[model samples]
Target: MTSAIDIAALDPASRDAGAVAHYGDPVREQRLLEEKVGLVDRSHRTVIAVPGADRLTWLHSLTTQHLEKLQPGQGTELLILSPHGHIEHHAMVTEDGTTTWLDLEPGSQLLGHLERMRFFSQVEPADVTADWALLSLVGPGTDEALAALGVDRLDPPDALDVPGAKFAQGTQPPRPSTIYRVAAFGAGWVRRVENGADLLVPRADKDTIDVEKVGLWAYEAHRVAAKRPRHGFETDHRTLPAEAGFTAPAVHLEKGCYRGQETVARVHHLGRPPRKLVLLHLDGITTDELPVPGTPVTANDRTVGFVGTAVRHHELGQVALALVKNNVKDDTQLRVGESTAQMDS
Candidate 1:
């Protein structure tokens, strides 16, 4: 199966209206995604796999991280809630001692709820999004652009020697290593982020890995400047994985009993999380436009929260990434339609 890299038909000043939103300089591809190195593509997204031998104890009994001690060149992030915890199916897992992969977001039902929970379970799961593609790389010259296309070296030891410091420490960095097969691609992976990494190749060998691409408006403006909470952008249907900050590496909270672990352990011990993802800034004038994904986010006029990705940030110019209403007041002043945000501090 092979059909994933169409990022606006690979440039002609891209802007395919449905994906590749930039190529002809999204603020110089967000300043080469913040100072050098950029790639991106993300061939739509959605992989899946799962391969048996009880694929990590049947996905650690079914979701929200801590995959039965996930070893083999680790990688994490998981979710699939909705027994009440809400966010139904987020992804980015990885494995290779038989398969686990995952990637995500492309109209998820997580492969029909992993085929209705496979009764006796030896797991199967499938959906290999037309044999995978993904892409991404990113900034700080992403390990010198994967060592100038020679590939391998997927970050870990000193996680890229300090340019964004793998998301400035709040954890979840080191964990990428298992897929291999690089050059001209038939199987690859990279996948780390907040500054760089995430390849996953082989949708017909992703045009043999060249480099310098960057778009989805500079990876949604560095994933809303790294507050990263995507799953239909910051969720809805009642979010909660501690309201989008997916509890460090996509929720584990001491794991054990999946499916939404009793509303993620009663909202991690009784309460707090009626929405609160923040990082707005947006007072406007990056040539005005921004504010799109579900917009709304008011405050004095009432609404309270909405906008999810927004962008324009080459050095935080028009930012966004909201969810608000967890008592909305990180210095208030919200709004959104006419612009005016705040809370980015």
Candidate 2:
């Protein structure tokens, strides 16, 4: 009953963005993920492998992050951009001497581009999506779960290290889980995505583990509450890293030339993005439904921005992330659907 074919027995009848949407009870599932050691089946996110002697240097020249200095097991993010400085592809990158592993949402044409760019380089890129499954654990129980699986020590500074002391929970551990706290999701923060960790496991060994399957509903609420940005939801081809406040983690400005470096550098030094990412606190005084994505945000009856994702958090009532023109200050009121929302600092 643990096979991919049998996971449907768990009633993973719901689907979102090509993945498991939920297991029937979204609220309870969310509770498990937030308050307990919960498991999420991330079969939706594609897993990519780039291996070779020149993998580090080759990837370094193509992405926004600095990879040449990456030690084995250090996980970071990479943003591939269009020449004029728009987000083209996004990948969660990590390396282990021989291979650079990546996890990403849809729109993963990165393998093709990586392979095409391998003219004389000794790099090899492969999409190992079918070979592995990403099983993520959410909540404070991550440490205990890892320890239960034989990993007693955690990485310092970067607690999110998956390789340093990373291990699994089944008969044999494979890619190891990266456990880290989500600092953005603080107690009083208007936006908090709650803390969680993800374990990358081999597809064959995946079904043997016992973990609660959380749905996208819970994930959406947590992510919106933390104000963390996602690829397709909060960004697109026209997005700049600075606009989403992701530059601090996703970009190494001091790194050498890469695609879209000019725009990133110029924006970091001189200009601000035309639009800025903001946290929207929906009008919770009423019983109206929360606003949904693609809804127009109006200020003083003037269209100014668009809503990204909104969620009714367990603690934060109704919250969402929006991209509004820089001129639209947080003090102003914005309209979403039939309800009015305010910007939260």
Tens-place lDDT digits, model 1, residues 9-104: 654432233356675667877887777887877776778888888788777778776677666656667777877778877888767667778888
In model 2, what lDDT does residue 248 have?
A: 51
Cα-based lDDT for every prediction = 0.70, 0.67
lDDT of 2 by residue, 154-245 (tens): 44324222111122224222211221222111110010113555566777776555666676667777677777887766775688987876
**TM-scores across all candidates?**
0.36, 0.81
User: Highest TM-score among the candidates is held by which one?
Assistant: 2
